[model samples]
Target: MSLPKELHSSKFEQYMESIKIMYLIDDRFKMICDQYCISKIKAERNKQKSEKYLYQQLENENLSQELEEEILFYIIKNM
Candidate 1:
């Protein structure tokens, strides 16, 4: 089986964007990845790979708010 070129290209680009955005949003993510022996490269890559899928699924404004709350809840809970 083979994927279309455009689909493969877009998926690759999204992965790059996610890694770059995560780095910009929090340098600590990079540090944590390193300190814990996480693959900084793979961490950035997976984050990038999932960014587009995540955004597309959460595009509804009302739902985004709800999702934000959920994320915040988890953050606070962990803290």
Candidate 2:
């Protein structure tokens, strides 16, 4: 199967294969992956914003970390 576009250059790069497998077989995992991607994109955009948007960047970072942890947990559990 082709690599998921969302997994490219992500923090979970090392877990690409596992993620691809889970993403296909597990709908919840897919949603988490999509959310993670969206969070990363928002964080990147927030970086270009003014200081007023600092909180948004921080929120996105936190969400990203939480999602990463959840993904890792799922992978480990399934493995």
Candidate 3:
């Protein structure tokens, strides 16, 4: 899949591999946004701006192993 120029580097490929795994779990970006209490517009904005943060959260973070859990925290108690 083609990505933004900024995401065309080798490190991006590594991240993309991990990103692909996340997508495999649930590619429904819309659903993910809803579950995460995030707006569609906000998600789109984060596509570029939050790539680094997302990569970190997805790859190294221990709080949530699955992207779904990481996204839609069951204990948030608020959306």
Candidate 4:
């Protein structure tokens, strides 16, 4: 998703990185489990916890007001 126009370049990049990392980790776990028939409940739980922390950390940063609102909505919806 595109970030708000008001976000600083660095902050926008950081936010993208944060989201990307969560996506990477989550996708990797899902792929591994699906392909290998591995137990995934524990890994899924751990990933959820980590993603929540990442979301909170991103929210705590100097995000643009619009991006902050969007992020909050995403976090709440996911939870």
Q: What is the lDDT of residue 59 in candidate 1?
A: 76
Better of 1 and 2 by TM-score: 2
Q: Residue 15 of candidate 1: its Cα lDDT?
A: 73
| Model 3: lDDT to the true structure | 0.56
Worst 10 residues of 3 by lDDT: 1-10
Give the TM-score of each candidate. 0.26, 0.50, 0.20, 0.30
lDDT (tens digit, per residue) of candidate 3 on 46-78: 886789788787676664457568566855746
Per-residue CA lDDT of model 1 for 1-79, tens digit only, reads 2222232344457675555566457778555534534454567779987997688776776688999999999999999
Q: With candidate 3 superimposed using the best TM-score fit, by how many Å does residue 75's alpha carbon deviate from the native? A: 81
Query: Which ten-residue region of model 4 has the weakest summed lDDT?
Result: 1-10
**lDDT (0 to 1) per candidate:** 0.61, 0.81, 0.56, 0.60
What tens digits encode model 2's per-residue C-alpha lDDT throughout 1-79?
5544657875877987788799889989888878887897788777767565787889899999999999999999999
Scored by lDDT, the top model is 2
Task: Flag clash pairs in model 3.
Answer: none
